[model samples]
Target: MDYFIQQLINGITLGGVYALIALGYTMVYGVIQLINFAHGEFFAAGGYMGVILLNWFIGRGYMSTHPMICIGASVVLTMGYCAFLAMGVEKIAYKPLRSASRLAVLLSALGMSIFLQNAMMLTQGVFDKPYPIELAEGSLTVGGITVSYLQVIIVVFTVVLLVGLNLLVFKTRIGMAMRATAQDKVMSSLVAISSNRIISLTFAVGAGLAAAAGIMVGFYYGSVRYDMGFVPGIKAFAAAVLGGIGNITGAMLGGLIIGMVEVFGAGYISGQYKDVFAFIILIAVLYFKPTGIMGENVDDTRV
Candidate 1:
């Protein structure tokens, strides 16, 4: 039982990271009906940015006196940086192809992904960048089960972000406009909602969330590489598809399920086949329910 609980906590922590990344996929797809293949690059950028900022703080001798504040500042800056980067990518790569064929837009997304990944490789180098400091270093043990502070922080932060996102989407005027635009772009434009602006905002929001995930991942794993985003990006996309691509709630559920499956499969079976297990579950889900676990038509409930 204790072993089961340990794996469960690990699964939730991993799931939270995937969920954050998956939200980017679902939100961008919900608003623009285009899968941004370059979305994962934003996650990579965030990880690099967080490491850069934290190292700078350490160099300035701030980390020793104010570690939490330094981390908070780095998180905010990295999220903002990625948000703007995503908006820029949208305007440069996607906006021009809006009226073009879907194939053209998809090709553009692929091109952007390749370009961004290579850019990171060139600028950041192919070497793995290690995190400067550990955020939380302690652990608690109860009933023979051990839980780390980092895991608790990750889970709590994820819940807070999820709740905040839900409130923003369901309770705010901006969210209403977003939903309106998603449901009917032409109709929403008729009401002066500015579909273009909403689409850009969607990209920014999604990238910001992915950026947060990147920071968490760096902390969890102790280091990050320029190519780190590719695999996790694929898994998060799978999670989004598993939950229902355009549905926010579905994405969250799908992330957790994928995370849990991977953890348990690795724990009980071969650790080398963990990635395979995640995709197996994805394929099984899609085979049974083509729409996904929460599959629904693109409507007001989406996004």
Candidate 2:
């Protein structure tokens, strides 16, 4: 009972992180129909940016003595840096390959991923950087189950992000432009919409969301490693596929479900097979619903 509840909370937190990462995958897929293999690196970038900025502030004694304020500052700096990095990635690795074969774009993306990871290693060194955590060490008791501040924050933030994303996609003109671009790039351009700009915007938004997840995960785990994005990337990709490759709402659903399965399966079944569990769910989803929970279309985009 209590144990189940505890694990459920853990799963939700994990899912929130994955969902955030998956949004990057889905958004990019929606526009360009290729997974940005380098998407995961943006997560690493966020972690690195946050830790470096926090340390700078701490060393300079510019912030108050409050740990939370320092953490918040670090998070904000990370988000901004990652947004820039995402836009830069669009200008460099992806823009040139947009018209190339899908396979070519995919390979290019893979190459970019490898390049960035190694570049970070060469520049930042191979050692894992630690994160500064400021949350008070305590848990809130609810319905006979204990939940930590970390879980609360993860769930809360994910909800806020999801709501904001929904509004951005459905209510705003930019979002309408995005949907139009997704529907038909040629038609969108015929209507005076810049497909190139929309694509870049999609990438930037996806990367920004992933950046938030990366920073949160770093703070939660108390460390940031250069290669830490791999597993999360795989899991988030699975979530994106499971929910529906190009469906925004589906990505959220898939991420939460994946998170729940991973956490509960590990706690109740075997920790060694947690990664396997995530993939197994993905496989099952693919097996039964070839197009995923939400169906995919010819354009690989959902308006």
Candidate 3:
């Protein structure tokens, strides 16, 4: 039916965003076995960066006249900025706590999350900032279902990012170093690989992906907020867990699945419980099989 098709497209768009955010979670966990709870703030920060930069450009009377150039610039700058920001966060908050107990690191992550959230509030103010420029408002009707240009762009970009990430992780030397470190930090160091640098790179890459997602989401929704990352961040985390927390491909699969479920559940069921569906699926998956769809056994994944 047309309605189902519509929801499917919507689901895929939402899933793309979630998968982007989820990659940050999975990547950090894969390398360090520490969940960067503050990763969501990186998403929020990206949105903020995009809007602020666009606002500056619009003030100069240029963004609207050159949408593509403005957008491309914003994305690149935001990703770069957030990448460095994430590295700084790792150096300040996580690096010091690396050898601490798991509980200590977890608490540290939580504290950092709260700190970042409030810091955004204090710096950007507790108000929603609208994206200054709007692009690609056209829509196409296919099979009695209409899809917006923005949706198409988001999906395409998501695919490109995922493919690029796959090539990076599976085909490149840095990726091999990443895997080696993940497999055994001690052994990898013995072989001359720098575990510390690899870990920092992992954070930077993950934050960059999340930043891209944040910019897209801000443009799609027409607004950004200081606390906007909270809910979607939680959903993305659920996606990561659902697909197998430490697996890159699993994060993508889990994100799409979560997105579809959330959209379809809201469309066919009740919107009030839409968020609940993702968590329930996560709980069910964990209960049935402790290791995710593509995850290795617990013993094999020791940190």
Per-model C-alpha lDDT, please? 0.91, 0.85, 0.91
Q: Give the TM-score of candidate 2.
A: 0.93
Clashes within 3 Å, all models in order: 0, 0, 0
For residues 60-169, write the lDDT of model 3, one tens digit per residue: 87876886787789899999999999999998888998889988988888888899999999999998999876757889987689999999999999999999999999
The local lDDT score (0 to 100) that residue 266 gets in candidate 3 is 97
lDDT of 3: 0.91
- The lDDT of model 2 is 0.85
TM-score of 3: 0.97
Which of the two, 2 or 3, has more lDDT? 3
> Model 3: runs farther than 4 Å from truth?
300-303
Instruction: Rate residue 50 of model 1 by lDDT.
Output: 98
RMSD of model 2 against the true structure: 2.3
TM-scores for all predictions: 0.96, 0.93, 0.97
lDDT of 2 at 41: 94
* All models, RMSD in angstroms: 2.3, 2.3, 1.5
Segments of candidate 1 deviating more than 4 angstroms: 298-303
Ranking by lDDT: 1, 3, 2
